[model samples]
Target: MIPGRDFPGKTALVLLTSLAVVISPALAFAHTGESGLVLLLPTDYYLLGGTLAVLASFCLIFLWPAARLERLCAASLPIGSLRVPSQTAISAIACLFLTALILSGLFGSRDPRSNPLPVTIWSVWWGSFVFVQAACGDLWYYLNPSIAPSRLVRSLLRRPAALLRYPGWLGHWPAILSFGFFSWLELVDLAPDDPTRLARFVLLYLGVTIAGMVLFGEDIWLARGDPFSFFLRLLAHLSPIDPRPMPADPARRRLFLVLPGSRLFHLPALTLSGTLFVLMTLSSVSFDGLSRTFRWLSLAGINPLEFPGRSAVLAFNTTGLFGVWLVVAAAYLGVIALGQLINPTWRLVRAAGLLVISIVPIALAYHFAHYLTILLMELQYVVQIYGDPLDRGWNPLGLQPNFVTASFLNDYHAVSIIWNLQAGAVVLGHLVAVAVAHVLNARLGGTGWRAVVAQVPLAILMVLYTLFGLWLLAAPNIG
Candidate 1:
C-alpha cells in the first residue's frame, strides 16, 4: 500500500477541478435563477468525483503495483483473512436494505420527493459495477456481507455440542440468495412507473432469492455438474498456479497442470459482462431520453399522437429499444467468446480496468457536452413551471411520473441535449476501452502518458458527438 498521504493531495486536486468545471458559470448559465441554485449542490459533484477517484486508485494499484497499498489492504484483513465472512455480511445488509427500501416505497404513498439519485446512478453505473465484479473476479465473494450476519446467527443458534459437526454450508446461502434475488429484480421485474408496485415486487423477489439459496448449496452445482468448471480444469494447463487444488494445497495436486496464465483466462467473462452491462445501461438511458424528447415534441404539435393511444405507442417504442439492447448484449458476448479462444490467459484485471479507464475521457467529454444541451433546452420550461429552479416541492408518493418529466424538460433543455450526446459517447467509450486494452497489451508497458493517449480517440469522438447533439438541441421544436 502506498502511503495514504501520497495520493490524497492528487485526489483532492482532481475533485476540486471537477467541482469547478461542474459549477462554473458556463455550465450553470442554463440552470439560472432558483432552479440553478437548487441543482448546484456539492453532493452531485462529490459523488461523481468519488467514483472517478476510485477508478484512478485501482489503476494506480494495478499498474504501479504499490507495496504500501498491498500492505494496507493486507493489514485491514483479520488474522484469519476474514474476507469471506465480511463479504457475507455486506451482501446481507445490501439485500435487507434493498428489500426495506422497496417495501417502504410500496406501503407508503409514492412520494415524488424521494431521491432519484439511486435509481439514476444505478442505471448508469452500478449495474456495470455489479456485473463486472461478479462475472470477472469472483468478487461476489467480497460483496456477500449477509454471510457474516448469517454466520453470527448460526453461531448463536447452534449448541456447543453441535460445534463438532457444524456444516460448511452455514453462511453460503445468504450470499447466493442475495445475488440471485438482486439479479431477478434487475433483469425481470424492473418497471418505470408505479414505484409502490415495483417496491413490493422487489421485496417478494428478495424472499424468493433468500429461500432458494437456503435450500441449495451455493457451490454444489458447480462442484457436481458444471461443464464450464471441467473445461476450466482442462485449460488450467496454461496457468502459472495449480488449478486442481486450492491455493492452500497446490503442492499435493497433480491431477491438473496449472501453468502461468490460468488467472488471466477468467477475465474475458468479466470483460464481456462489463461491456454488455455498460451498453445496456447506455441504451436504456438513450431510449428513455429519446422517448421523452419525442413525447415533448408531440405535445408541442410537431407530431400527432396518431390515435390518442399515447401509452400503447410509448410502450411499443420502449419495448423495441429494449430488444435492440438485447441484441447488442448478445453480439458483445459472442465476440468475447471468440476472443477467449484466441488468448485464454489474457490478464483480466488490468485489461478490464484499462478498458473502463480508456472510456473515461469520452464519458467526461460527452456528459458535459450533452448536459449543456439539456440546460439550454429546459431554461424556458424552468421559468414557466417551477417559478424558481431551486424550490423543491415535496411529493411523498412517487405516483406522479410527471415530476421527472417536468424536471427534465421544463428546467433543463441543456441536460436533454447532453443526454443525446451521451448516447453516442457511451458507444464510443466502449470502443476506446477495447482499443486501449489491445494496444497496451501489444506494448507491454504502463506509463501515464500512454494511458492518456489511449483515451484520446474516445475524447475526440465525444467532442464530435457533442457537436452533433448541440445541433439537434438547437433545431426548432416542431411539437
Candidate 2:
C-alpha cells in the first residue's frame, strides 16, 4: 500500500453522509415533538445501561486472551471477485445527478423542506446514504463526481500526470477543513437549507473538487485533499466488506466478507493529520449535538422556547464548535499520553495512530445515533419530492404526491423503537470500539497486567463517551 494512497470521504457523510444529520438548521425543529418526546422516555436508564455495557466489554477483553482477540480482529469470511460497474460511467451519472440537484436548488421551491436539493443532499445523501456506505464498503468510490470527469478534462487538456505532486505534509488538512466548514454550514450558517445558498455551496464544493482534481490528478488530489471523498474513504474502513483491498491492481482486488472493522488492521497507520481528521469526524458531530442542547442555547443567551433562528447564536456555535473539537482532541491525546505514561514501552505516535482506529466505530455510532431520526423523517419528503421534483406536482413515479406521513413519529410505540435503536447504536459502537482497542492492545501492548493497565484509560474514555453520546441523544433542546 502506498503511504499517501486512499482517502477521507466520498463525503463532505459523512452520515458529510454525519453529512448524515447534515440535518438542516431550518429543519432542526421539523421533528421537534418527536425528539422532545424522547425527553419523557427512560433515557437515563438507557444511558446507564450503555455505560455498563461498554464497561463489560472492557472487562471481558481484559480477561480474554490477547491472541484470541487478535484472531477475532483478524477473522474474515473470504468472498470472491467483486464485479463493479464502469467507474467513469457511474461517476459521470453521479455528476450529472449532482448538477440537476444544483439546478434544482437554484430554481426549486423556496421552502427548504420543499426543495429537492436540500432534501436530497441532507436527507437522502447525508442522512441515510452515509450509514449504509459506512457499513458496507466504499460505495462512494464509484460515485465521486470528480474522478472520471476530471480525468476526461485532463485527457482533453493532454496533461497526463498532475502539474505538481500533492505535498504529503499538507496531509488531510484540506479534508479536515472541508468537513469543518461543511459542519458549520450544517450547524451554524443560517439558511443553509435555503435552496439558493445550498446551490452556491454545492457549486463551490464541486468547482473546488473538480479544479483540485484537474490540477492535482484525480486519484492523488481526492486521496490527499477533497473533503467529502477523504471523509467517506476513511469511514469505509469500518465497513464489513472489503471491496478493493488492493487498489493498485484492480483485477487483484478480491472482496471479503470480513468482521466489521477487520479492515482497520489492513489500513496503514494514520498520520497526525489523518488522526486529527478522524477526530474532526467525531468532534464535528459532537458539537452539532452539543450546539442544539438547551444548555448551549442558554449559554448563548437564547431562550429555548422563543429561540431565535441560527443567525442569533451563530457566533456562539462557531466558538462552541471549535471549542468542543479542542476539548475532544485534547482529552483524546491526553489519555493517550496517560496510557503511554502507564506503559512506557509503546511509542507515543505509534500508540496514538494505531489506537485511533478504535475511535471509528464511535464516530459512526454518533452519526447513526444523531441522524437516524432525520433520515427516517426526511426520507418521506425525499420520496414526496421525487413525485414532483419541479414542484409541478408531477407524479412521474405514480407515488403519493406530498404524501409524507408523520403518524409514525406521533405513535408512542413506534418512537419507543426508534429511541431504543438510537441508544443501541451508541452502545454498540462503544462496545465495538472497546473490542477494537483490545485487539490493538493484543498486537501492541503484549499481554496481562501491563496491557490491561495501558488500556484502562482508553476504556474509561470509551465509557464516558458512551454516556456522553447517550446524554446528547436524550437531552432536550430548542429543536
Candidate 3:
C-alpha cells in the first residue's frame, strides 16, 4: 500500500469513543416521514445530551498536542488509480445528452413521475449524483456540458487562445451569485417540479453558461462563472481521492486514501468572497431544512395544516433565506474574532479561512441527513421512468415491474435501521467536525491550555449548530 504516515491510535480511540457515547441508545431516535414509521422525535434530552457529547469531545481533543495532531491528521493510504479518458469527448457527449434532457423537459409528459427532466434534475442529479461527486472526486470537470462544446470547437479550429483576460478581482463573486440563484430556483421556485418549467430553466442556464464560456475562456469561465462547477470543486475537496495530476507525470493522476476533510488543511486563507461563499453553502442547506418545519410556519404566522404553495410564501422564503445566511455569517465571523482575541498571534483572515473548513463536516452531514430519505423515496421514479421516458408506454428496456415503492420505512426493523443510519450520520459528522477543529487549531500553532481556551468560541458555536441541526431533523413537518 502506498503510505506516507500512520494515523495516531490515541486520536482514533478518542474519536471512536466520542462517537460511541453520542450514538448510545439513550440519545438516539427520531425520523419523521409520511410513511407512518417515525418512532420518536428528538426531545430536549436528546439535544442536551448531543451538545454535551460534542463539548466534551472538544475539551478532550484540545489536550492533545499539535505535534501528535499533525501525525494523526497526516495518515493516508495509497489506493489504486484509474486512468481518465479525454475530457473533450466526455464533455461533448454529456452536452448532447443534457440538451436532449432539456427537450424532454419541454415536450415530455406533464406528470413529474413520468417526465425524465424534473426527476433527473431534482432527484437523480441533485439528490443522488451530487453525493457521488462529493465522495468520488470532481467528475463534473469531464462532464461539464458547457465547457465541453467550447473545448471541442477550439480543438477543431486548432486555436487554444483565450480572447480576454479574466479579472483577478472577480474572485468567484459571479459563482457566488449563480449559486445563490440556483439555490433560489431549487428551494423557492414555485414550479420547480413542473417539467416544462424545469426544462426552460435548464435551457436558460445552458445559454448563459455557453455565452460566458465563449466570451471569456472555458477554463477561466468555468472556474469563476459556473456555480455548479465551483460547488462541485469545493465539495470534491472532501473526497478521499485527489484529482490533481501527479507532479512527476503531469498526465497521470494518483488516488490517495486520506481522511475526509484532509485537503482543507492544505487550503490557504480564503478571499472575502470565498469565505462568504462557504457561509452561503451552510446557510442555504440549513434554511432548506428549516423552511419545511412547523416552527418556521408559526414564526411566519401561517397555518401548517392549510399551508399554501411556494407562491404564497415567496417573499417570506426569499427574505428568510438571505436572513439565515446573514445570521450564520455573523456568528462565524464573530466566533473567529473571539477566538483570535484569546490568542492574538493568529491572523484574522487566516483564522477565518481555517476555522471555516470546520463547517464542511457539519454542512455535508446535514445535507446527507436532510436529503437521504428524499433520495431514497424519489429515486424509484428515476429508475421507472427510464423504461418510458416520454410516458408513451414504450418500454425500451422491457423492465419487469413498471413501478416500485420504497418499503424500507414501512418495515419496523428497516425503519430502525434507516433511523439509526440517519442519526449516526449526524452524530459522526459533528464528531468529525470537532476533530477537524482540533487539527486546524494545531495547524494555527495552538497548544496546551491556551489552545483549549482559544477554541471555546468556535467550539460553542459548533455545539449550538449541532443542537439546531438535530432539532431540525426531529421537528415535525406540520407546515
Q: Which candidate is the best by lDDT?
A: 3
- Whole-model lDDT per candidate: 0.36, 0.72, 0.74
Residue 223 miss distance in model 3 (angstroms): 3.2
Candidate 1's residue-wise lDDT over 1-479, tens digit each?
11112334454365345434433323212211112222333544533443343233234323422233222222111112111234565777765655555654655435422423224223322333332331233343445323344344445755312233324443223333333333333333334334576565545544443333333323432222222221223223222233133366533322322212223322332233334344443334333334334444464354543434344455455455566467645543443343333444434333443343333333333333334443344333333322321226533343344444456545566444544344333333333333334333432344444433443333333333333333333323222
- The TM-score measured for candidate 2 stands at 0.86
The TM-score-based order of candidates, best leading, equals 3, 2, 1
What are the models' TM-scores? 0.40, 0.86, 0.90
List where candidate 2 sits over 4 angstroms from the true fold: 1-48, 78-81, 244-254, 395-405, 443-448
- Each model's RMSD to truth, in Å? 14.1, 7.9, 3.0
lDDT of 3 by residue, 243-346 (tens): 54677777777777887766766766666677778788888988987888888988888988889778878999999998899899899889888988888777
Q: Per-residue CA lDDT of candidate 2, range 1-479, in tens?
A: 11222222332112122312212211111112236344554755655655555555566556666555555455455567755678889999999999888988888788886678998888788877788788888889988876677888889989977877788788878888888899888888887789999999999988888888888778877876887777688679888776654677655667766657667665666777777878888888878777778888888888888887877988888999888888888888888888888887777777877888888888887788678776777767777677677677666666553333446666778776776666556655665676677777665654457767999887787677656755665677755
